[model samples]
Target: MLAGIRQALPEAVCLVVDDNSPDGTAEMAREFARENGCEQNVWVKVREDERGLGGAIRAAMQVAIDNGFDLFCNLDADLSHDPVDLPRLVETCLSENADVVVGSRYVSGGAIVGWPWRRRVMSGMINGFTRTLLRLPVRDASGSYRCYRVERLAGLDPPRNPSDGYAFIQEVLMRLHREGARCVEVPITFTERRHGTSKLDLPEAVRSGLTVFRLLATR
Candidate 1:
């Protein structure tokens, strides 16, 4: 994913916020960046797991904000998000005058390939429920493949105890909307990763659903 992104947007700053993966994923990313001579444009951030996905993303956002980049993209390093879509989404946010642009799976042209029926069903149910509960117009509130305007995100104090897993995406979107960010969704086909097992389990899905309600209620 990093290689593809580097090939696509060589000038764009890419920050990799890595948790302590036992697989040495961070080392691989750094080596790739160095080998490609894009180390100046890429930075590897290591954080202990005091918080999870949401916290890591927030930390990255803070880095971007501190560095004076007005917009930044957040995505999983697992290649579920197509790096080729980055430029279009970044362009759309600037052209369409949106504060957030989501690479959506539930929008008009969006599709998910290689997921089982149960995964699809559960995703649909949870996103549908979240849409109703949060009143967010975005078709894919839980999508992590997104670009955010740093100014909008910087001004808001979003939830401190944000969900660590999939619900991390959900909370950020809802909070961005709640804080008056103009969000737009763009359809993107989500392809399953070829390498690893799914990070989400049955317990995590249920936990995400409950976490959504908890966030909605608290907000």
Candidate 2:
């Protein structure tokens, strides 16, 4: 994943937040960053609490804001999101005058690779439910592959989006849509991760569903 980022955006700064990965993933990433001569551009911030993906993203977002980056392109480190599409995503936001640009799997040219029928159903169901409940135009509400204009949404002070894990993606999308943020969809092929175990579980599914339901009910 680091290699893909380096290959795609050689000049862009990359900050990787490691949430106490027990498998030495953080160390390996640091070595790869150094070997790739991204020691200055690439950084690893380790968390001792291991809160979750959302926590890691919030931490990264803070760093981006503090460092005065105009935009942020966020993707999964597991390679589920194609890093090769990074430049296109960034360019789309700039050219379209959009505050957010999502790499959507449900768009016409988008697709999923190596996903089982059950997983596909889950993704579809979650996104479909969010669309209907929230009245959102985005096809993929739970998608994390996206680019954000840091200043556009007021830099995370927009709202207290209630989510912790994968659900945080959905929550943020909902809030953005609600806030009338202009967003564009860029189709991309999403591949299932080749490394690491799947993080989704029955409990996470329930939590995500409940979160959407809560968000909808309050609205």
Candidate 3:
């Protein structure tokens, strides 16, 4: 993941925010930065206090805002999202005058690889339910692979997003749509992670579904 990003977008900062995983992910990233003498652009933040998907992303967005970047792109460190598509996302955002570019799997040229029928069905069902409930404009509201215009993102204030889990994806989208952020979906092939096991369990999925309903109720 790091190597691909370095090759594709060398000038961009690779921010790896870890919730202090036992597998030493933070250590590995930091060591690589030190060894490659790329610590200036390669950053690793290990959160010792709190651990959650939304919080981690919120923290990272804060860092990007603090650094005063004009655009911010986020992808999975597990390599599920292709680094080569980074330029396309940025280009689409700039060309279309969009505030957010979603790397979508439900779009015309998008696809999901390696997931089983059950997983695919569940994902599709959740996304459908979310769209119906929240009236989110985009087709792939649940995906995390996205690029955001920093000025628009800062305007939304990610820290105020309600979800603290995977559901943050849709919640932020709903919020952005409400705030009139123009979002475009760029098709991409989403490959299943090769290394780690999936952390999303049935319980977590249920909680995320409940969160969707809560957000809709509040909306």
Question: Which structure among the candidates has the greatest TM-score?
Answer: 3
Q: How well does candidate 1 score on lDDT at residue 133?
A: 92
**TM-score for each model:** 0.94, 0.94, 0.95
Residue-pair clashes per prediction, in order, are: 0, 0, 0
Over the stretch 111-202, how does candidate 3's per-residue lDDT look in tens digits? Answer: 99999998898889888998888888889988898999988878985444467788888888888888999999999999999998665667
* Candidates sorted by TM-score, best first: 3, 1, 2
Off by over 4 Å in 1: 49-51
Q: How close to the true structure is residue 53 of candidate 2, measured as C-alpha lDDT?
A: 72
Whichever of 1 and 2 has more lDDT, that candidate is: 1
Candidate 1 per-residue lDDT, tens place, 1-219, comes to 887897777789889888877789789878988798888888988887554676788789889988989889987777888899998899999999999999999989999998999989888888888888988879887778998998888887856676777787888788888888899989988988878877667887888889988987887
- Which tens-of-lDDT digit does each residue in 43-121 have in candidate 2? 8899887677777777787778888889988998888998999999999999999988999999999999999999999
**Candidate 2: segments with Cα more than 4 A from true spot:** 158-161
- TM-score for predicted model 1 compared with the true structure: 0.94
Badly placed stretches (over 4 Å) of model 3 are: 157-161
TM-score of 3: 0.95
The lDDT leader among the candidates is: 3
